[model samples]
Target chain A: MHSDTKAPLALKLSAIGGLIFLLAPIALIFLYAFTTEEKSYQFPPPGLTLKWIGVTMGRDDVWQALGLSLKVAAIATVLAMVLGTLTAAAVARSRFFGREAISLLVILPIALPGIITGISLRSAFALLDIPFSTWTIVLGHTTFCIVVVYNNAVARFRRTSGSLIDAAMDLGADGVQTFRLVILPNIGTALMAGGMLAFALSFDEVIVTTFTAGNQSTLPIWMLEELVRPRQRPVTNVVAMAVVLVTVLPILAAYYLTRDGAETAGSEK
Target chain B: MTSPAIFAPRSGVLARAADWAIRHPRMFVFLMVLPIVLWLGIVYIGALIALLMQSFFSIDEFSGVVQHEFTLKTYAELLRPSNFAIIARTVAMAAAVTLASAVLAFPMAYFAARYARGKWKALFYIGVMLPLWSSYLVKVYAWKLVLAKEGILTWIFAQLHLSWLLDAVLAIPVVGGNSLSVSYLGTFIVFVYIWLPYMIIPVQAALERVPAPLLEAASDLGATPKQSFRMVLLPLALPGIVAGSIFTFSLTLGDYIIPQIVGSGRLFIGQAVYTQQGTAGNIPLAAAFTVVPIVIMGVYLWGARKMGAFDAL
Candidate 1:
């Protein structure tokens, strides 16, 4: 593309401004984590200290919340992988009645407001007399996480060749063998990316967890409580910084993994 | 990989079961879809139906218990002046947020889609996504700090001799409060900040679909750059914009926490539902309030489908 066809200077500047708007608040969280002043958000901190980091680490509730979040994300990611991959295979490779409706059903959990999912599950649990526990949170997380993995896996599955399975079978391979040798390897990265995204989503999920988690506190819920009733402002900031790292790392890893191979093959079209 | 498959017993039960599944492909598909069906059907659809049922039921006013018999009494309550204000305010806020995000996101998406090179493209992806995937609650809280009375924004305005400018803006009528942190404006800003990336991704995707060659073809056929953008580019990006708007609009309509943390005492629909169920103990009315977003989004999505927005999404 020529300079004339490239993005105009004003447009480039506007994009930079947009990026700054998106990032500045997150950047402030990291900055304020080390602020010496505990009472407020200061322009330039009176002084910088590592005090909040130690304070946040010593808090038992923070650790417990973090542990619960990690546990829920792990379980939800595994469940989503199985459910999402199977559904994706069914939708992508087979001709089924109401396939489009099934696809729409998978997306609805995510596309709707989280509060609706939250309250609906809360009421359903009430009606069924199912106690709200870690499993309830897992159920809520899996409901939306399935969409992430299905979107990834179905795209990859469509791009994958059907003849590869036929060729494997022609070489005297059974269904298990064909899937093990052909399908898994082919869709593995996309599945991994999907799983990673699902994990990240579950890690930081708050609104649904608020309704489904009866007595449990995930990290985001913990942060919410702290913000509403702050013991020390910077402590939440430190936790927020850590939460950013935990969620962002997997998403970045997913991006890198997906951008290179068959994972993004369908999207490029 | 080959060794495990080769060493597996050919005539064994596992092999036979796999072979059986292969032979009955329809059954295989059914089995694959069965768990998803049960999960979604029992959990999602059943839950929705339950909510709808609760909405039709009325609450005993004095006893404060849900009377589960079918009635339109709760929905009639939704039309009450106070309850209707919550729905109207929430819808208005959601529409404003969606429009602001769309206006702000278009140029950025255009830049990323059109001219970003390898490293820049990677930066654009990670940059938008990092903020996107981070803890949403934390970002909203961070906005509280940024917009607080003695926060960095005020400090910046003071440094630039623009304190009165900030004051003048905050001195307005309905939306204003004591400060930005407690104003409706603050909630609106935080909402746009949080959901802005949802708008960006799809629009960038749509714009990326309009390849360079196509634009060049349009220009070569005697169209100016502006004309090419209007005639060639706008049509391609509209679906993506509409797609992003669905996310921004619906997410805003359903959010409760932002108003609690950052706004004035006005209630959004989500907060109304939350408090009705939790604090007010009015489950029936809460269910009725929940239906508002559901109906709005159902209609909005159906309309967008007609406009072919889901293709970009």
Candidate 2:
């Protein structure tokens, strides 16, 4: 009993330490955002100011880059969800030859290093004479985004009782009707969770985007450029905060959904 | 009903085509896989061929044109001591970050999988993944603030009366002063933090698959808690640890953005490729640079498969 008690306490302390490690960098950003320093190396800012926020909000370039990023992410997420759901359904529902091979192809983009994907996409675009554009960026993102949606949907499909579909069909329901009333209801949460994850992945994706995006800059790319140029640290912070909030909210929603599912699964077993 | 009334020959052609599609499901499968294959072949393979060819040929300085003379000039240049040093440094950095991410992520994964329940578990998992959702640029920017001399960390040190420790660490002769200011260390720290979620999620998924009954059985026997963990849990979770490490290692190795933003253009393979393509205008050399990493990664993947790390991911 004493040993068990000691172990949990030790684990908890280690967990808290991990949390601090995660938050320290974030907290540092928040602190610097309010600083009064001109350069970045000062130990302590002499004062604090809200000037950086205004500067960030006023910058047109930052807005342009952010808008481009949003546009790419939105388009990519929708495409991935649709294709991923279709592919998942086809694979999970119908037994077919070469199924594993097809699944492997779908998972490859995410499993392989992003650099390989980027280079591959870049070469294909060049071959098709598809000029580097926002479309190319979307293509690259959707490739990997599909993997997340597929994983979630497949898991949901596996857990869902096959009898429910059969019973609905037996009750004089047509294929579409059975799908609408039975299938959709069961997988609704899964799909929503998958979509959230896909969106999050698309939002943060940079490696492939860098290669596919010919000249246009995403918010991340813009921040990278600014880092090298060195005049826009505060504005960068503002945009960073915006990104943190946007990405985090949806992920929280997705987590709650998945957790509910996991608990039910645990209880069922 | 109209088939008979329609042209008999045309009907036969339609039937044959339908028969062909059904007969060769491989064809359908091939078509379905075509997009990605074409993507890989045309873009990936094509560019790689172009790059490989470029590496062999030398560039003419008289008119600044790439001349198609088959030679090992670029490889020779890349093999030089200074360039080799850069590769060595990058590998070391990548190895360190992978180790750091694994150590940091293991406990988090363990806690979420073994202890947390219901909504709290979900919330904690989401918190770990939330950083992944944010823009990569924003996160890197946040790190810059954290590590900057005038950043929050410095301020916190002063507030806590720990500035002496900070100064002492920063001022330690050859090991500290110049190196701390260079930003590579800051970049390494941020990379580990930013990629932590990726490492954690897969490991958690793997660890979660370990049956609770097995652990109980071990404990119920003569084995102590530590012994049970060491003997059973660690062996089962080994696949996940390996899977997560590959992500951390490869990501750190290939990433140009974090290093570019945080490492201040200190050359990494990714940055080297970007520079060769964009700044130096040496497309061939850049392509060669890109191939170096791919070859290395290919070898790594093969090794990973041999070790059975592929199963977990």
Candidate 3:
């Protein structure tokens, strides 16, 4: 807070430059979505139009891919919420052998490279005769999705006072009643935040999905295909704009919900 | 009336089970954790083990089918000069990206942690996080457009009458080419842009923990600002830097999409593994190649854990 401790003008200027570097490409994506050019990227488009939005909306394939991505993310978020809540309850509320190991195990899915998870899941499915379907994609997604929920829930659970449960028990409430009335309300926002973040993560995932989705194209996979093999490129940019909207909103919501909670988690250290 | 019903036994089996579980905390914990352990352990870890095992089994060169018998032949093949070059290139790129992100991120992280306050702080954080929220593929592809022959970078260089600057840089060996879009430099720039936020957040977190008194104390003790930053701030922030690098390095190391789209068709570990397993049908080699990043990250994470990096994450 001291004036003497403040950053120099040059440092602030460079930070502004860094922000521009980060955002310029995203800004370009939005700009080009309205460009009239369909074949190649023109620095200064000759014309701008809103017609690509209409075209993108009319495409059945885009709808199918978007629907599949939403379904997969929803299912994966539900799975992560249940399993991750249980994990947080156990690790945060009770002492156990191998607890740290379990935490590490939970984080491993996301901590290791996505390609490793993709390759492993791909082979494991083949070995077990599990066909690559939407279900397969869900399972693959749930692996990393669990980590996000676990991190959030565990932090909130730790911040929750154990004495609340004891107080409820002393007041003649049963376990279910204590959980339903006391514990649930305390961690509800945390779980909601975790679920939203998990959903966002699952929605944009491409690498693992590439391996686990046999013939299926999630929104990201479709976007990748569209980029690699060009066809009416502006249409893909329009779809990208939609994706940015869908994913960014949930992430912002999660940030607001968790911003206060983060201090208690001591993750800032 | 409610007290009378409270003592009554629940009619459903599930309700009785809930009653039993609440009374027995240990068993409750066990029951609560069993499904997750089974899912993560049997399914996820089991898959990883299976993949590792596949690496040991050899592929028949003639039939292009993976054999059940164990062999070290695949590992030996991975040591070939071309394969080694790919490994070296990927690691070098990862290191370079990590360094670039850290250097670029530190000043911003410092400014946010120490100088900015209240709404300014919140705006800075939002700026850092906004890019992370956007689609990763879209960002990479956007960079593709920006670096294309007739894209924004070229347009700017042409306007500046310095078009030959980029051309001269592109004229160099392996890492360069005819245009920015097809060069390793382009891929490096995009990688740094994508992962910069990861570095900034952790570094900011670490800097936030450094007390104002500590810096003031250093100044009081006759340390120059630069000296105090080098001696005090850098050491304090080392764990966070390591934590951030863990994300950037591993993410870059295993990414195939950026290289596939932006580079000059140079093979990274991810692309090689994808091609080997998907196209060539050589499962063993792919598995063997996959082991490289796993081993590298295993060591990196172990070191990071020693530095107390997980707490920051």
> What local distance difference test score does each model get?
0.87, 0.71, 0.86
TM-score-based ranking: 3, 1, 2
Clashing pairs in 2: A40-B150, A41-B149, A41-B150, A42-B150, A120-B44, A123-B43, A124-B43
User: Which parts of model 2 are misplaced by more than 4 Å?
Assistant: A1-10, A28-58, A81-116, A123-128, A143-146, A149-194, A263-269, B1-45, B52-64, B67-73, B111-123, B158-164, B171-181, B205-233
Candidate 3: list runs displaced more than 4 Å.
A1-6, A96-98, A249-269, B1-8, B23-27, B213-225, B306-313
lDDT of 3 by residue, B171-267 (tens): 8887788788889898899999988988998998888888888888999999998999899989988888999999899989999998888888889
Candidate 1 scores an fnat of 0.70
How high is the lDDT of residue B259 in model 1? Answer: 91
C-alpha-based local distance difference test score of model 1: 0.87
Clash number for candidate 3: 0
List model 1 lDDT by residue over B217-282, tens digit each: 998899998998889888889999999999899889888888988899789999998999899988
RMSD (CA, angstroms), candidate 3: 3.4
- Candidate order by lDDT, decreasing, is 1, 3, 2
- Which candidate ranks first by TM-score, i.e. highest? 3
Q: Any idea what lDDT model 2 has?
A: 0.71
Clashes of each: 0, 7, 0
In terms of docking quality, model 2 is: acceptable
